[model samples]
Target chain A: MTTDTYQAVQASNINKRSTRWAEFLIQSGLGLCALVSIITTIAIIIILGKEGFSFFQHVSPAEFFLGTRWVPLLEPQSFGVLPLVWGTLLVTFGAAVIAIPIGLASAIYLSEYASDRVRSIVKPILELLAGIPTVVYGFFALTFITPLLKGIFPDIQVFNALSGAIVVGIMVLPMIATLSDNALSAVPQTLRQGAYALGATSYEVTTQVVVPAGLSGVMASFLLAISRAIGETMAVTLAAGATPNISLTFFESIQTMTAYIVQISLGDAPAGGIAYQTLFVVAGLLFVITLILNVLSQKILMRYQEVYD
Target chain B: MSTPNKPAFQLDYGDLKRRHRKAKIFANFCATITWMGVALLAVLLAQVSIDGFKWLDWQFISSFPSRFPAKAGIASALVGTLWLISLIAIISIPIGVATALYLEEFNSKNRLNRLIELNISNLAGVPSIVYGIIGLAVFVRQLGLERSLLSGALTMSLLILPIIIIASREAIKTVPMSIRHAAFALGATRWQTTWAHVLPAASPGILTGVILALSRAIGETAPLIMIGGLTYVAFFPEGPMDSFTALPIQIFNWVARPQQEFHELAAGAIIVLLAVLLLMNAAAIVIRHKAEKKFK
Candidate 1:
């Protein structure tokens, strides 16, 4: 071969190597971007573990888990986290009670009964509800819902569990409605027609054919919505008063786990103090419960998706 | 028509009637619930508007918070939100989009990819306050960013990254695979194809997602509170390192107070917040509508 041709061939080989190198660089760069999320997850766990473990050094597991009356910032400070957990559950249960039937009904109406125009309008309105800030909901709870509740029950506290539950329920409603609608709609149209042909009424078709077919999705939505209610902070904090009560009374002031986090956060708890440490412990518990619910919901959702798709 | 006589089987009129009635009642029940939901939304809007309409004046818009409710305004809160949002947008968009690109276009479902996907989902499920906790520990204390706008923005960016990545991935997926094939059939490289063809095609959908994510960040007070961004800042954020207060934080503080006037101020701030949210949502919806229309 000529020397010039040989040099040209070498240059082409060099060019191809550079191109491969460039591709590698680009892909790794994007991969690094994806790594940021993993890094975030690791960071969350480490921080929660690092600071959260210190809270345990002061308060025993039995006291933190089994004990009642959480008064971490008082004269005789107690570290029992059960009151906060109970309050969280009380609000979550109340919110679930408010959200489930109504949200499911709306889902049924939208997916099975409503006209397309109605669906279009109602869906956006529901999205509007979802888009409204939790802070705004907190404001609404304090200013509107509590006063409204107080009218009927004259002895209700200014910050009670009922208004918090109602608002949180409202917050989670759209999730249930939308998710269940998707689940119900994913059931084949032919199944509905078959049910109709078999002398099933629309109600029968919806309850038996549609809902059963989409049971997992509906379940997942419920789980996820409830999980959301568990994590809801501002609304619960504002509506439910900071007095950590062990009882499940809707009329009384109560503090939730989330509310306690905010309470400690808003206070002048020094970072290394037991008061601040309690914040992490409570947050760690909140994280675990929510993570479990979330994982279960996703598992259910994945199963449903696999079945449908 | 003459063959429609009851020849095959006997029809139970009473049972059919009962069933029809039950169906009608159930349908009506669901309808009532839906209408009630719509009505509740209307009531919420009306209540806020009524309470805040008189309070929302020029003075309320331009001043800062005060011990006296009459002197408190949304100016600092508004500026802080702007700074936070702008910073969050800048920090999150590139990382989110790049991650989405990696997941959607650049890789197969390898172990690392699977881990990333799982991590993102779990992160998405993590509560906002938990993100705030992480922010406080990692950003505020560890990195010594303190209670600054940058810390708040970074915290929120982490909180919303999963959302942005998921949405962006969905958008990128909608860009037809054939587009990639066509680019590769030519001399274009993978990066070139994604950058030139795929990104533009997916830009509108990506934009809608970005706007919605940003709107979510706007209203979040929990994580910001955790990171100490809920301070009673009287001045606007001058830089990324400045301590700031967001609209929701301000509204939260006011609503937390016992005074009636502060509650009214909270109501007014809610109005501003809702208006901003509505605008961002409208922009997102319009973009989506236009994109859908282009296909039709």
Candidate 2:
């Protein structure tokens, strides 16, 4: 070969090597990005676990779980987490009572009754509702919902679980409606037709056939919505009073696990003190609660998901 | 016609009529409940708008927080929000998109890949405040970033990273496999094919996801509150290391005060926050529509 051809071959070899190097670099870069999420999960678990373990060193597990008081700042610093847990459950239950019926009904209507135009309009509106900040909902709860409730029942306090529950219910409504609507719509058209052919009324068909067939999806939506309600912070912090009372009454003031965390964080709790450690302990409990709920919901969603060709 | 006769069993026409009527009423009731939800949304928007418009002026946007409610503005919070969002976008988008690409294109169905997928889904559901604790322990304390804008942004990026990855994966999945085949047939490497063809095709959908995630990040107060976002910053943050306040935190502070005037200011700040969220959502919707049309 001539010298010019030999030089060209060498340049071609160099080009191939550079391309291979670029490919390797890009692949590894992408792999590292994927690893970031795993690293984050590990970091969260380690940090929370380490701090929470330290907290257990100071307080016994039984007292933290079974005690009814949560005054970590005052003298005699009782660390009964039951009050906060009860409060969280009360608000969550209230939210569920308010949200479930309306959300399910909305999902039913959207899936079965709505025209295409109506679905397009109403669906986006629900998305808009979901996008509204929880802080705004908190404001609305304080200014609108609480006063409205007070008008109906004069015994209601200015800051009560009912108002917080109602507002949170509203916040979680979109999630339930959207998810359940997808579930409902996912049922095969042939199933609905089969019911109709058997002289089933539209309502009968929906309630008896469609909903049962899509039960897992609807249940998954409910679980996800419940999880959302449990994890919600700002709305509850504002509307539910900061006093950690273990009351079951809807009209009473209560402090949820999230609200307690917020109160301590905003306050002048010295770092590494009991007051600060309680933050992690309660947060750990909150994390466990939500994580279990989320994992359970994911399991239901995956296991019972109906497939159609 | 004469051959028509009643069946062996009675039809019970009255019972049938009653059942039909009940069904009709129940259907109407469901529709009414759905509309009630829409009405609630309208009432919420109206109340906030009415309370907030008076305070939403150029002066309010330009000035800083003051002891007097009437004079107070969201300038610092707004700037802080902008800074935090920009930093989050800078940090999260590339990582999220790359992770999405790896999951969709590089990885095959395996135990590790399935675990990664499960991890991402679980991360998406983790409470935002839990993310704050992580930020506090790791970024703020361990890394010594303090309660600064950088720390807050890093925390938020983690919170929303899962959401972005999920959305990006969805977008990537929409790109047909034939496109990949064509690229391969043309002697393109996997990375080159994904980078040049697949990404361009999926860009609009990915853009939608980014905007939606940013909208979520902007309204987040809990994690930021956990990371010690200042509620009373009077001046804009000069750098990522400086302390800052965000729109939601400022609103939360103002609303918590007992004064009615501060509540009004809170409403005003909410309007500003809502407007930003609305704009971002609208952009996402528009882009999604365009993407749908192009792909179709």
Candidate 3:
């Protein structure tokens, strides 16, 4: 009996020690997995900064920022970033204009009025729209939307900002609607009840109470959508013409920053050459723009995040 | 004489009724707008179907891409996409799951944990193109992986990692605390309890997230473009080291050409892509529903 008890105790102790070691090993392994994202962020900065900074050495920041032309392959290469920035802004603006009203209204309807059954069906369909590839959207823009626009306005170019903007707008509609719907739904039910109790109609309650309460989240959604629009590449690349023209007309073709990167990548730009380095510089700018928007949106989202127990 | 003086802005029943009517109309209008968005999507799908249906055949699926749109097939792109997605799944799933496990189960609510959380959310929001750039620099050039299928897959893995991690964390959170406590009372080690019980329970949800992420990765074009995915490849990739084109890249190339036949081919490819996405999404939804029922 004594021998059996001793053996049992020894086995238990061994098991405990083994468990401890396993726990340590697994924890550290998982912890390392979590570090990969941080490492990626660092890698982006290092890669883009190293090459981007190098581009600045060849072309002053002033000329890069303030110049009006972007012909890197030509003899007198000008790297002015304004035209690309303007194209991005135009597309973003147009998308916002098209998406905001429809998207917000959809959010209001989905959150406030739709039956649970309708919501379940509509929600997945919206998600499907969101899940459709951007490249598919590019094809749709080029084949469907552009032609339709040209039919309506015969003067419109085949590759125009309007087509890209409209497609991107549709692409972002789900984002805005989903986020704003979440925001609207997160508004305390008691507030809506209170408004209703005060003889306010359902619309009044939704518009006056829920919308105001969720305004910050809605705003954040818009900002995030705009950021997404700015960064959008494939659809814009296919629909918007690759000319870096500094035009204000939506019907005319223009090259976006992302399109410029694609153009450079597709061409045979020698590794580490100025043409190659230009891609990094543009990428850095794109990174900065998106990072700023994301940070701002996060701040807005957090600041207005309502807590309920 | 008996009533007190009326308030300066007394409620008017007629005006209130009118306002209510207006509000109802506006609400209906909003609902109509919502349906319009759905209608737009329907139209898009219909248009693609009409254009692409004739070209979507067994022959289209088996043949290699050719200069002539009538002779071209998506076989190379399809095979390449499959290889890329498989490699991406292999590379990303373990890391993503582990990250979620660490964040949800191991880390205390400390500064480092908070920082990690922030980093993940930021990464999730980072543009896919930026990831492509990182892939070009780190994987393709710096590590000399070249513009091969492996490099593209690795890039895509990074792009979708944050999404998988977030979804996995959510799944883990859904697992009840009681299960953990019960396992602990039975003297099971933390890793044993988690690996044996919690992970199994969370697997369905994790799988759903993974499927969704893969769907997104499959549709992605920009990052792959930045990673130098070939626009045209006549042969299927033999291995991870071989250069390959994805469906999206192929579609983009076709759509860019002025040839009407190529545009039709692009439409056909879109149909195939969309069909795959739909199937995956349906599977995910079914799995999620099953999981919810099981947990309940």
Candidate 4:
């Protein structure tokens, strides 16, 4: 009887041990999987920094960041980067102007006024627009928007910033609209009723009460849209010509930082070459700028959520 | 109803009429702009159909890229996109789901968990081209994967990981705590409870998210270009390590050409790309609306 009891106890211990082992293995396995994102972030910084530092060793930061000209691929190659930065700002702000007001209005309509059927139809259609690839937008800019712009401005170049800005605006409009809609709808229903009780019309209630309460989210959406505009590559690359001019007119051909990266990517810049290193440096700058904007947007959005909750 | 010489809250019919008129005008304004957006989308689709329909045929789908516009097809690009997407889904989903599981089930509130969550949001905001830079340095050059399908797939996989993980976690979070508690009460280990109950309950939502993320990867262009997927690949990629071209790259090449016929070719390829995207989205909707109702 003692011997039987000892054997049974041994078997139970073995069973318990393997089950515990399996549970431990699964938990750590998941933890390892989660680490991949951390690794990606580290890889981005290390690779960009190493390559960017290599480029900075040859070129001064002042010249790279503050110079006026940016012809990095030609004779008398210059790397001022000012022109590309200027080009990006012009296109990005231009898109902001187009997307913001319309996106806000659409959000108000969808959240405060639309019938359920209308909301159902409009939301999916907006999503479908959002899902279209950037390259297709690029094509539309080249074929449709550029021509339309040229018809109005006789002196406009074939590859003008105007078309690029317009298409990028269209590309980001859905995002702004959707995010702002969520924020607007999240406002307590009692606020709207209070405004109505005070003898306000539907438009007044929406504008005065709903919009103000959802302002944080709207602002966050704007920041996120701006961040996306800055990083947008393909549509601007195809629509705006590769001429890195320091001009603001939508009529002139301008090249963005993203387009410059795309241009180099298409060429056979030997790996480890200075030209190749320039890509990483520019990307690093782009990454940092967008990262700051995104983090700010997220913080604002979270704080806004906390206020409601 | 007020005493003489005393100011009272008076309803001015004229001002009220003006305000109501203004409200009506503004409402019409919003409706017009919203419809205008829909109209713009319609124009885009119609324009693509007009430009592409004549060029799209059986031959266009079957033949590979060529100097002649009529002879050119998306045979290689179609195949390459299929290969990249399948590989990306395989590589990203398990890790993304596991990461979600770890965050939601194993450890809910901790410094490390918060860091992981923050890291993912930042990664999502990192521009796709920035991801391309990393892909070029690590996958193509450092790992010596070259400009192969594997490099492109890995790059796209990293690009979409944040999306998938975020979606998966949101899904997992919705699977009521009672489900887990019941499984535990039945003498199930944490892994068994998670595997048998939590994952099944979340699968519909997770599947929808996965399909949407995969569709996004399919339409991406700049990252693939960075990894040299823009090279002229005349033949179908034979393996993961074989060099390839994708639909967006092919369309970009065609759009860059100064010829009208090539522009039409780009439109034709876009039609194919959009069709694939539409299919994926429809599937997501079916899962979200039909299959997910049970969970609701």
**Judged by DockQ, which candidate is best?**
3
| Candidate 1 collision pairs | none
Clashing pairs in 2: none
lDDT by residue (A1-309, candidate 2, tens digit) is 566865665565445878789888988899899999999989878877888899989899999988888888999889999999998999999899989989999999999998999899999999999988888899999989998999999999889999989999999999999999999999999988877777778878888788887888999989989998999999999999898998869999999999888888887477788887888888888888988999999889889877765
How well does candidate 4 match the true structure, expressed as C-alpha RMSD?
4.8
Error of 3 at A207 (Å): 1.5
Instruction: Give the CAPRI rating of model 3.
Output: medium
- Tell me how far the alpha carbon of residue A10 in candidate 1 is from the true structure, in angstroms, after superposition: 16
* Local distance difference test, each candidate: 0.89, 0.89, 0.90, 0.91
Please tell me what DockQ candidate 1 reaches: 0.50
Q: Which stretches of candidate 2 lie over 4 Å from their true place?
A: A1-15, B1-14
Per-residue alpha-carbon lDDT of candidate 3 for residues A9-28, written as tens digits (9 for 90 to 100): 54664477776787899899
lDDT of 3: 0.90
**Model 2: lDDT to the true structure:** 0.89
Give the C-alpha miss distance for residue A24 in model 2, angstroms. Answer: 2.1
Complex DockQ per candidate: 0.50, 0.46, 0.54, 0.49
Task: Give the 10-residue window scoring lowest on summed lDDT in candidate 3 chain A.
Answer: A5-14
True contacts kept of 4: 0.69
Give TM-score values for chain A, per-prediction.
0.93, 0.94, 0.94, 0.94
